[model samples]
Target: MFPTLDIQQPRPFDLVGSTILIAGNAAGFEGTLSITVSEGHDEVTGIASVGSLGLRQFQASIYIPDATAFQLTRIFVTIADDTGNENGPSVVIPVLFGPRILAGYSGWQPYTVRAGDTLTGIAQSQYGNADFQPIADANQNTLANPDLIFPGQILRIPRNDI
Candidate 1:
């Protein structure tokens, strides 16, 4: 029987760090599973051991290249059968890739939006420049419009030192 996989953490559109923590349940397979992260341009794949007697939980960390980060708004994280088949059973989780999760800066600072706040303003205040692309890219899941953030909305300000 084909394996079944389900991603539980970092739900759709969540901002991910350099080292992503993927947790989920798997069934119908044993030995190992494949974890792939792709931006439709480039992809990284890793392997995780799975002992499938029945449904069981699994966790794996897949490292992403900085060049791949924020290049696209959304990336797909997939856990699939490792039989080298493109049509194998798998689960794809779409998430927003953050740029601030570079090698050195692997974390993000949370910023609460307030009235009259703009991406440029926030960028200038936080990054000392008017380049808001990074902020917009990191929070694309939350802020659809770069100029349309509302109060009480939380944004992830990537801790980019690189």
Candidate 2:
């Protein structure tokens, strides 16, 4: 037999402007569990379950972004058996900064032609960088080609510096 656990978060979260509710479940055996969120080397937050759930289901939620942005590089969940054994898995959630205009720019900012930006040249004129690849990578599925952007498409411009 195999131990099982499942965790999920709603997608298309807003950056610097949304709240996320984290929830999940576990089976087989359990005494306590720990949940953690991180961004690269930064530890965002964590919580531990004090109650018991033997062969039953468990659920909890952690509020993301109380006052600031909920920038996350990874999310991890761990379950420990009563025998002092632990098992679980982690999930990575990509982070996008924001649509904030750079600085001192009156008109819309410039953007490069990423992999899927068919209108990349147009974006370049607006953003000034030809390396629009990050845009494509960020919105991989939606952007089909470098020159095939549809109307009302929102693209995440990579920050100039981390």
Candidate 3:
């Protein structure tokens, strides 16, 4: 492609960690290329260089900790040629970044229970609060006991800000 903005990673509903790989190529453009991911009040931006082959292959990263979880994050990619011809401000695609699992709605996020992870611990680690009842109630379909959870099981955590 002559001039293209392609997203090669973090596909829709794909489980991601604190650091999600934001990769793509903006070939045929020079100058600077910036890839930005923003959700709510949190955003991560990165820059990559154009190679000698007249291709700008970017393999940058965006860290969202627990901020962008359960939200429709906007992917903004832009490129400018050496002569200052700008290609974007273009919104490439919208992707969901979650902690461990992705729920169907933005009001909730999923977390894969790890070994020795309790609901209260999950709640504390995720929301910075140890109240696990909200998590247990939200994940009734997936978890039968708030006191016990197994690894590799997906548990939903409410996105309610406390």
Candidate with the greatest TM-score versus the true structure: 1
TM-score for all predictions?
0.83, 0.41, 0.43
Ranking by TM-score: 1, 3, 2
lDDT score of residue 5 within candidate 1 = 75
lDDT of 1 by residue, 3-46 (tens): 47776876887777767788877763555788888877778889
Of the two candidates 1 and 3, the one with more favorable lDDT, higher being better, is 1
RMSD of each: 2.9, 8.2, 9.0
Q: What is the lDDT of residue 66 in candidate 1?
A: 68
Instruction: Give residue 149's error in model 1 in angstroms.
Output: 1.4
Give the TM-score (vs. native) of candidate 2.
0.41
Instruction: After superposing candidate 1 on the true structure, give the runs of residues whose Cα lies further than 4 Å from its correct spot.
Output: 1-3, 65-73, 83-86, 100-105
The lDDT of each candidate is 0.76, 0.42, 0.55
Deviation in Å, model 3, residue 17 alpha carbon: 2.3
The collision pairs in model 1 are none
Ranking by lDDT: 1, 3, 2
lDDT digits (tens) for residues 27-109 of candidate 3: 53454556555555545666556553654566756565464443543333222233334534343544434332333324567
